[model samples]
Target chain A: MINNAGPSNSAAVLDEGVGPPSLSRLSDADLSSMLLIRHFEKNLLKLFEQGFLHGTTHTCLGQEYVPVTVTSLLGDADHVFSNHRGHGHYLARYADAEGLLAELLGRAGAVCGGVGGSQHLLRERFLSTGVQGQSLPVAAGVAWNLKRSTPGALACVYTGDGTWGEGVVYEALNITALWELPLLVVTENNGIAQSTPTGQHMAGDVRGRAAAFGIAYERFTDTDVTRLRAALQPLVEQVRHMSRPLVVEFVTHRLGPHSKGDDSRSPAELRAVRAADWALRYAAAHPEQFERIDAEQSRRVEQVVAEVLARPLTDWSPR
Target chain B: MTAPRVANDLNTALHRLFAEDERVILLGEDVCDPYGGAFKVTRGLSTRYPHRVRNTPISEGALVGVAGGLALAGDTAIAEVMFADFVTLAFDQLVNFASKSTAMYGRHLPLRLVVRCPTGGNRGYGPTHSQTPQKHLIGVPGLALYEASPLHDNHTLLTRILDGGVPAVLFEGKVLYGERMFTGGVIDDLYGYDLADGVARIRLHDPVPPDCVLITSGAMVHRTVEALRELLLHDEIVAEVLVVSRLYPVERAPLLSLTGPARRVAVIEESTAGGTWGAEVATALHPHLWGTLASPIRLIHSLDSIIPAAAHLERQVLVQSGTIRHAVKELVHG
Candidate 1:
C-alpha cells in the first residue's frame, strides 16, 4: 500500500488548486513524499561531491513537487517513463533510495547493473530513459502495447521543457494523439534546459501545441504539491476509464543548475522560495509527526549510504 | 517439386513467409486494414492474424523504437520503412538506439527484428523518397544487413532473420519486386546459404576457370552473374561471381575462400565506390589474400552523385552487366 504520511490538513489544497478540477486527490502522505524527494536530492549532491559517484546526473531539485504529486495520482498497474531527471518520479512511486544511489555509483548492486549509470537510473518496472527526450516515443510505444494487450495499465511520460522541441517528441505526440493512446504526458517546465531558459528556447505554449492536435490539456505550478496532485487526478481517472491521451503542463522551477557542470549553481532567490514551499511548511507544522518522518527518512538515507559504501568495487570494464 | 511460379509481387512474398511462421509480425504505417501498407507488402497479413499485425500512425521513430523494445521483451517484429528515404527520419532510433540497445546493455538481443526497407531507384520517387542509404546504417555493431536480390529469397530471408535471433535490415529492391526470372532448376533459398563474414558464389555457368572473381550484391548480383556468362571469351578465363546477402556480418569466409586462390578480384555495387562495400572488401581482402592476388582489387561502382531521373543517366550511374563484365575482363587481362 502507498503510505500516506504528510500532515493530514493539506486536503484543502486540492479543492481550490490553481489549475482545473482534479479527479484524483493527493493525501497528506503524498505531501510528505515531496519532502522525501528533496531529501533524496540533497543526499545525492553530497554523495556526488564525496567521490562516491560516477557518471552524469540531472537532479530534479526544483521539480520534485511535480512527480511527487502526479505519480500519487496513478494506480499501481499504471507505468511511467521519465527522462534524464527521473529520480523524483521513480522514487515517488517505488521509494527505493538504495537502488537509486547504487545505480548512480555504477555498482554491480545497482538496478540496471550500472550499465545504466546516473542518468539511466531505473527501478523494477518504473523505467527512465536517462537520456533527454528519448523516452517520449518509447513511452508512447509502451502505452500502445499496454492498451492493446493488457487493457487496464496506463502509461505516463515525464519530459523536460527542452525536450518538447525535439522532432521525435512531436512525432510520438502526434501519433499518440492520433491513436488516442492512453498516456499522460507531463512537461516539467523548469524555466531552463541545462542553461538555456524556456522563453529563449521554447516556442508558444506547450498546452497550445497539444490542443492543436486535439488533445485534452491542463497546467499547474509546483509550489503546492497537493494542488498538482488534484490537477492530475481527473486526467488520470479519465485516461484509465476512457483510454485517451492527456497533457499536463507543470509550471515548476529548477532549484539547481542542470548538473554539477553548472558553476553558478543555485541562487539565493530559489532557496528563499523553497524555504516557504508547502512541503517544508507541512513538515515543520507536524513537528510531533515531523520528528517521526525525519528519523525514518534519516534512517532510510543512512541505510542506503551504508549499503552503497559497504559494497566492493566490481572488476568489470566497458567493451 | 517447387511451388508453381506466381506473379512476383511484394504482397505474395510477404504472404509466403506469414504462412511459414507465427512469430513474424508486420508493424508499420498502413500495414493493416484500409491501406495494407504504403507499398502493400503487408496487404493481407492483418486479415488472418489480427492480434499479430498492427498498423501504427506515422511514427517512424516509434516504429523502430518499439520494435526494439518488443524485441527486448521477446517478440519478433518486422518493422517496415515505407520508403528507404524516410528511414532518415528514424536514423537515430535505428542506429543510436535500437542497434546499440543490446550490445550497450551487455545482453544478447533475443529480439528478431527485421527492418524491411524498399531501396534503390526506378520509380520517379525523387530525392526525398528514392535514396539507397543502407550504407549509412552498416556501422552499427549489433545489426545484420541484407539486400534481397531475388523475389523468392525475400520471403525466405524474412523467415531466417526472424528465426536467426539477430536484428537485421532486409532491403527489398524496388526494381525487382514485380520482375520475373526464368530458370531450369530451383534456386536454393539464399537463407539456406550461410551469410556470415563474406559472400556466396552463385554460379550462372559451370567450371568457372577462376581467372578473376566479380564480387557484388543486391540488384547488381543478377546483372553481374549475367555479365560473367556473356563476356567469357574462352573456357580457361572463368569469372567466379560472389553475391553477398548479409552486409554486416558479411559472408567473408566464403568470399575469402573463393578469392584465396584467384589471381585477381573486383568488387562492384550500385552505391558510391570508395567508402562502403567496395572499400570494406578491398581492405579485408588486400591484407590476408594479397600475396595470392595477381592484381590489386578493382572497385566497379556508380558515380558519387544523386541518382538522376533520366533512364540513360540512371543506367550510367549504376553498375550494369557490361560494367561488371568490363571490370572482370580488365582485371583478368591486367
Candidate 2:
C-alpha cells in the first residue's frame, strides 16, 4: 500500500511551470502520433472558428505524449477505456484520423455512425465516454473478463486528475485490487480539472488513493515517449502475468483550454504550462526528424479535414 | 417444487444458471454463503460455483458498471442490489453507462447483464430502504425491466433474458420472497388466469366483457387479485386482472389483445401516481382504445409520499387489496 503523495506538490509544480526532464529523441512513430494529435486538436479549434464544427470538444494538446506512449504498449486483445479528452487516446491506438474527423463533422463514414460525437468514440477494443468516472468499473469488469477468458490480456483506462473526485473510481480500484484483475489505470494529471486547479478539487493525491486499495502506483514526470515506453513494458507485463491492478500517473501539462476558449489561467500560468510541452523538447532533441514529421502530419491532417468535411451527413436514426 | 416460495424458486434458478453456464457471474453485497443476499434468493449458489458467485462491497454503482463491462466481454453477469432503494445509488451506471452502451456505439453491444433489485415495501423498511423504484427507470432504451410474481417462473424469465442478450433489471418483490409460487388452478383459490407473452390476465367470475379492468404487477398482483374477487362476489361486477412483469417498452400488441374485453380500466400501482409506468400503459392503450373505453383509463397509485415504517401508516402510504377493490368500484360506477 502507498502513502500520501502529500499536498501542494502539484501546486508547486503547476505554478512554477518548470519544464519536464530533458530526454533522448523519440521514434518516428511516436513523434508522428504526437504531432498527429497536435495537428488534429489545433485543426479542431480552427475548424470551430471556420463554422465547420459545432458543440464542445476537449483537446489533449500538450498531454498527447501520455496516450501516444501508453497505447503503444497495448495489443488488440487488450481493451482501452477513454474519458472525455480522448481524441489522442483513439488516434494513438488506431490512427483513424479521417474517421475521427468525420465523426466530429457528423459526416458519412464517421465512427459510431455519428451518434457518439466528439466525446464518445467506439472501435475494436476501444471505447470512450464523455461522462467522468463511469468508465473505471466497466474497465475493471473488462479486466476481470480478460483474466478469465483471454488470460494474458489487460484493460487500460485513461482518466483526468479531476475525475479522481468521483467515488466510482475508488470503488473500481478496490475491486480491481481485491480480484487481482489485470487493469491499468492511467491518470493524466495535467494539474487541472476543467477550470479548477488540482489543489482546489483533489485532496491528498492519486498515489495515496491507489495505495489505499493496495494497488501498485507509478509516476511519470518526463515526456520522452521512448523512455516512458521502456519503463512501461515491464509494468504492463506484471499487470498481465500477476493479474494485478496498476495506476500510472503522468504529471503532465495541458497547454490548451479545458475546452474551446475556456482557459481561466493567466499569462504567467500559461507560460508555465508551455514549459511542459514535449514538442519543444522533441524538436530540440532531433530538429530534422521533428520538422519533417511535423510538416507531413500537419499536411496529412489538412487533407483529412478537407475530405471528411466534403462527405454527406450520417444516416443513423434513433430506434 | 410447487410449494417453493419466490425466494426458493429464484435460488433454484440461479443454481441452474451457475451449473449450466460457467461464464455467468454474480456480484453483489453479501451474496455468498451465510448471507445469500439480503433476500436470500442467492442461497447456496456460491457453494457450487464459487468463482462465479462473488461477494461485492457496498458499492452499487460500481458493481452494476462492472457487470456491464463483464457482459461486454462476452460474459453474462447478474448484479444483485441488497434492496431496491439502493438501486438509486447505481442510476448512473444503469441509465447512463449500460443503457447507452447498447446503441451509442456504431453497433449494438449485446450486454448480457441483469441487475436483480429486490423491491417494494411491506416489511416496514421505511423511506430509504423500501421502494418500488422501477418507475424511475421507465422508458430507458435497451434496458429491459421485469418483476417477480406468483404467476411467473424465475428460471424461465432469467433464461429467456440471458438468451436475448439484452441488459435487464429484474425487480424482485421483497414481499413475495416467502409467498408460494403459483403453478396452476385457482389463484388464492379464487380466480383463473392465463399466461401469455410473460403477462398474466385473470378473469374473476366468467369470460365476459369486464365492467372494470384492474392492471397491476409484482407485489401488487395479489392485492389486485383479491380486489377483483371481492368485486365479483359482492358487487357482481365481473372484473379483469392483468398482471405484467415486463414493465418497460410496453408490448402494445399483446396488451391490446389481452385488454380487448376491458371497458372501464384502472392501472393500480404501489409507486405513487406521477409520470409512472401506469400512466405510460394508459397512454399506450388510450388512443388505441379511445372511444371503446367507457372513460379514460384511470391510474390508481399510492399517495405521493415516502413510505412510512409504521404498519398502519405504511398501509396508508402503499397500495392494498382494499385499495384496488375500492378504486375499481369507482372506475365502474363513478
Candidate 3:
C-alpha cells in the first residue's frame, strides 16, 4: 500500500507545468469539449446565482485534461462512473452540453429527468451513482457484468482523494483485482480535497496503494491530456482485450474550492492566474491550429449560449 | 389414513437448493473453511459445495452492498446474518438500495435476493445479539418477510420466497434451530397460501363460535397454542387463533375474514409494541369493527427495552403463551 511517505518535492516541479501535452495539438472536437466544460461551468454558476441549481457543484476547471483524454480512449459501448464533481466527466463522454445545462437549470430536457441537479448529471452510457465513495462498488459491478456479457467494454470509475479513505473503495479494488475484472479506477488528485490539502489528509500515494492490490497503477498531471492518453491507452486496451484492472492518478490543483458552496478564494483571481500561462504557452506553440480550434470553440459556445438563453424560464412539459 | 413424506428441514432444504442450482451461492461470515457459522446452520455447506459457499470478510455493509449488486446482475445470492443484531450495518443496502431499486428505478433492476437473519433471545447472548430486528424492516415496502418458528415452516417459507422473485427476509429463531419436526407426517397443505399474502393458521375446535380471537406469531405461537389447548379444559371460550407465518404483505383479508363475530380481540407479540403488526391490526380492527366488540382491543407485548440475556429475565420482559391466554380470557369475559 502507499505508505505515509513525506511529500517527495516532485509537485514543486509542476510550477511551470511543463513535460505535459500542449493544448495546441488538440483537435477541434477536443477544443469543443474543453469549451463545453467551460461554458457548462459558467452556466452552472448562473443557475446557482438564480437559485435553480441545488446541492454542490464540483467544476473540473483545472482537471479537464483527465476527463478529456481518458474519455477520448473510450468507445460509446464503454462506461465511466464518476463522483459528485461529475459534470466535466459526464459531458466529456456524452458531450450533451445543453442537456447538462438544462439539468442544472432543472428543465424538462435534463438528462436525469431534472430530478438530479448539479451534482447528479447521469446519462445512459455514462453513469454517476449520485454519491461520494459509493460509485466504485457499482462500477465494479458494471465492470463485472461487462466482463461476463460484453467482452470488450471497459468500466472506468473517477474518484477524488477524499474517497480514498472509504473502506468500500478498497473493498471494490480488492474484488475487481481478484476477479480480474476490466475496471479502470481514475483518481483526481487535486492536491486538496474540498478544503484540506491531500498532503495533510491523504495518507499515501494513491496510485501506489492501488498497485499494492496488484492492479496496474499509473499517475500524471491533470493538465497533461496527451500524457494521460499515453498512460491510459494501454490500460483501456488491456481491459478491452485482456480483462485486467487498471488505475490512473491525475495530480493537479483544484483551482476552486471543491464546490459552489465553498468561497475560500476569489474565482476571478484563480481563473485569471490559471488562464494566463497554460493557454498562452499552448497558443504560442502552434499558431495555426490554435486559431482554428479557438474559432470553432467560440462558435460552439455562442450557439449553445444563445439557444439556452432564448428558451422559456419555466419548465412546462413533464419530466 | 395417510402420512406425509419428510420434506426435510431448512438446512437440508438449502443443501438441496444449492445442490440443484449452481447459481445459488451462500455468502456470509464464517460460512467456509474452519468456522461454518456462529449458529452452525451452514456447517456442512462448505464441505458439500466448496466453490459455491463464500466466507466473506466481517463487513456487513459491504457484504449486503455486494450482494445487492450481484443480485442486480441476475445472480441468486442468499446472504446470511449470523445474528439479527448485526443486520443494522446492512440496513441501508436492504432498505434503501435493494427494496427501493425496482420501485424507485422503475424496475430496471430485478433483485432476487434472500437475507437469512437468525434472531431471538433464549441464549445467554445479551441485548446486543438477541434482538428480532424485523420490526425495523417491516415499514419498508416492496420487501417481504418470512418469520419461521418451525423447521417445516422455514422449509416451506424459503421455497415459497424463492419462487416469488421479490426481496425477502427469512427470520429464523435461535431457539428453534435444533428443534426437529416429523417431516413425514401428513401436515396441513398450506403450500397454496399466497406468499405475498401471509397465511393465517386457524387451529380448529368443535362447536366453534369464534367469539374471541387471539392473534400471534413466531415462537410465541407454539406457546400460545399449547396454553390455549390447556385453557379449553373448562372455559368454552370458543376462540380462533391467527398465526401470521409471513409477516409482510400481511394477509389482512384472511385476518379480517377469520374474525367472524369475534367482537373482542387481543394481539400478542414478542417484538416492540410500537409501529408493529400488533399496532396495525388493532388500528385496522378498531373504528369500523368497534360495533361488533364486547370490549376494546388489547395488546400483550415485550417491554420497551432490549431483550435480556438470562432466560428468566427474558421471560419476565416478553409476553409468554400464558400471557396471550390471560389476555384472551380477560377480553372475552370482562
Candidate 4:
C-alpha cells in the first residue's frame, strides 16, 4: 500500500505558485463561510466530547475550499449532490446553521425534520447522503434532466478517494459521458478513506480510470482557494456551455480524524497535518483580518447554536 | 372509448400522456420505435415524441436513478423496467432513494416518477425473467404500488398517478398485456364496478349474495374471475371478486366493507406463498373480520419455489384458474 508522506511544507507548495490573493481581492463571503465551517466543526467536536451530540460526523474541517470555492461558482438553480463528509458543502449551499445544528440535535425544525442527521441533508438544490458513491449515479440522473429540460443548469457531485472504489460510480460515469450530460464529478482525494488510507483501498490511478471512459479529467495538487477558483471558473463555464461531464480531482489533506472516536493517525502525522492547515497558514500570514473574520464567524455560530438549543425536540412519531 | 387490448390501451395512454404534457419523458431499454418494449406497451411512443422517449442503456440502476433525478428537477418521468425481475438491480435507487427522498427528507422537490415494471410469471421465462416483486416494495413509505388490470381504464389510472405528483411503481402483468378488455358488456351473472378507492370489483351472479369474497389484483383477476364463473356454474357457489388497482396504502376501508357479510375470504395472487400480497391482505383483514369469520382467511399463492421454464411445470407452480377454483371450493366448504 502507498503511504502518504504526512503533510508537505505549505511554504514550498505556495512559493512555487502565484502569491496568495490580498485581503481585498479575496471573497469575504468565501472566507467567512470557511471560517463558519471550521468553527461549527470545532463546536461539534466539543459537543461530541461533552456527550451532547449523538451519532458521528465526518467533518470537512481541513478541506473547506472544496465546497467554498465550488459552491460559490454555482448558480441557485444548479444542483449539488454531496457525500458523507459534507458539512462544509451543506453550509456553503446557504443552508441555515441553526437548521443544520438542529438536525444534528434531532429537532423538529431540522432540515429533514430530524429524520436525516448530519449525513443526509436535503434541500431544493442540494442533496447529501451518508452512503458512499451513491451521489454520482443520483447526480448523473440530475444532469440527465438538466441536459434535457434546463439548458444552462448543471449537476455537481462531490466524492472522496474512498468512494472511487464503488462500481456504480463508473457506471454513472459511463452513462453521463455517453449521454454528454452536464455533470461535474468532484473527487476530494484527501489520501484517506475513514481509518484506512486511500492507497490501500484504491488501485491504479484515478485520472487514468476516468480517462478510459473518455471523461475530461483534471487534477489540482493543492487546496489553494484562489487557485481553485481560477481553475474551476473556466471549467464550470465550459461544462455548462457544452453540457458534458467532467472529472476533477483535488489533492488535499484532512486535519482531523475520519470521524468521532477515530484516532488512527500517529502523533507525528497529526502534528504535520496541523502545521499544514490552510486556515492557520492564512491566519498566520494575515493575522488582523483573520481575527476579525474568525470573531464574526464564532459569534454567528454561537447565535445559531443558542437558537437551535432553544427549539423543542423533534416529534419522532411517524408522519 | 372502446375497450382495447391491454397492450393497446397502455400504448394509447403513453401517447396521450406524451401529447398532453411535454414534461412526460419515457426511459427504458428498447423503449423506442420499431421495438416499443418487451410487452409493446410503449409501442409508437418514441415516434411521436422523439425528444421525450429515451432509449436507455441496459443500466437498470442508472435508469431508475436518472428518472428520480428528473422527477426531482420538476419533470414527470416514467421509467420502464423491461422485466420486474430486473428491479433487483435498482432496489437502492427505487426503495432507498426515490421512495424515501420525499418523506425522510423534506418534500421540497416533487418526486413524480412512475416506474413501470412488467411482472408475473407464466411466460416460461424461468426464475430470473419471471417473478412478482411487488411484495418487496408494498410497505415502502412515500412510494405507491399500482398493478394494472383489464377491468379498469389503463389511461385513467396512469393519468391519475402521473398527476398525483408522487413516486409510484406500476406493475403491469406480462400475460395481461395481450388479454382482451371489456368496456361495456352485459352477460347474465357477470357485472363490473369501479370503486372510488381505485379498486375494480366484478361480481358473478348479480342477485346472489356473495357466500365468499375472492380478493386478487393484476392478471390474476382474470384467473379468479374464471374460477368464480366455474364455481357458480359447476359448484353453484356465488363469489364476489375484488380486484385491487392501487395495491399499496391499500384502501383498507373499502376492502373491509366489500368483504360484506361473507364469513369466508380468500386472497389469490401469482407471487410466492410466504410474505406475499395475499399475506398482507390476510393479515390486514384478520383483526376486523375475525369475530364474524367462520374460518381463517385463506391465502392461495404459488408454491415457495423458483418458477420453472417448462410449460407443464410452470403451470403447476403458478396460481392458475384450476388452483383458484379449488381454493374457492376449499374455503366455501371448510
Using lDDT, give the best candidate's number: 2
TM-score of each: 0.86, 0.96, 0.81, 0.93
Q: In model 3, which residue pairs have backbone atoms overlapping below 3 Å?
A: none
Candidate 4 — which residues are off by over 4 angstroms?
A: A1-25, A107-109, A314-317, B107-109, B185-196
Q: Per-prediction DockQ, in order? A: 0.34, 0.79, 0.27, 0.57
Runs of candidate 1 with Cα error greater than 4 angstroms are A1-36, A75-77, A121-124, A222-227, A263-278, A315-319, B1-10, B16-24, B30-35, B47-59, B69-75, B122-124, B181-200, B233-236
lDDT of 3 by residue, B1-334 (tens): 2322222256676787787766676778887756777767777889988866777667676666666665665667788887889888877667766666545422234566888888877676889887767778875776878777552345566667866777888887776665554233211331111122354444442335666778766556556666566556556666656667677766577777777677878887777777786777787778666888778788877778888888899877766667767777777778
lDDT of 1 at A37: 73
On TM-score, the stronger of 2 and 3 is: 2
| Candidate achieving higher DockQ, 1 or 2 | 2
**Fraction of native contacts, model 3:** 0.13
lDDT of 1 by residue, B1-334 (tens): 3442222444676777767766556788878966787665677789977877877777787777767655644466788888887887777777766666554443343467888888877565655666777778766776778877652355555666777776778877676655553234323332122233434555433343567877777666567656765665542356766767776665566778766688788888777655676777787778877777887989987778788777777777766787777777777766
lDDT of 4 by residue, B139-182 (tens): 88778888998877888999878777668999999998888775
> If the candidates were sorted by their TM-score against the true structure, best first, what order would they fall in?
2, 4, 1, 3
Docking quality band of candidate 3, CAPRI definitions: acceptable
Positional deviation of residue A22's Cα in model 4 after best superposition, in angstroms: 13
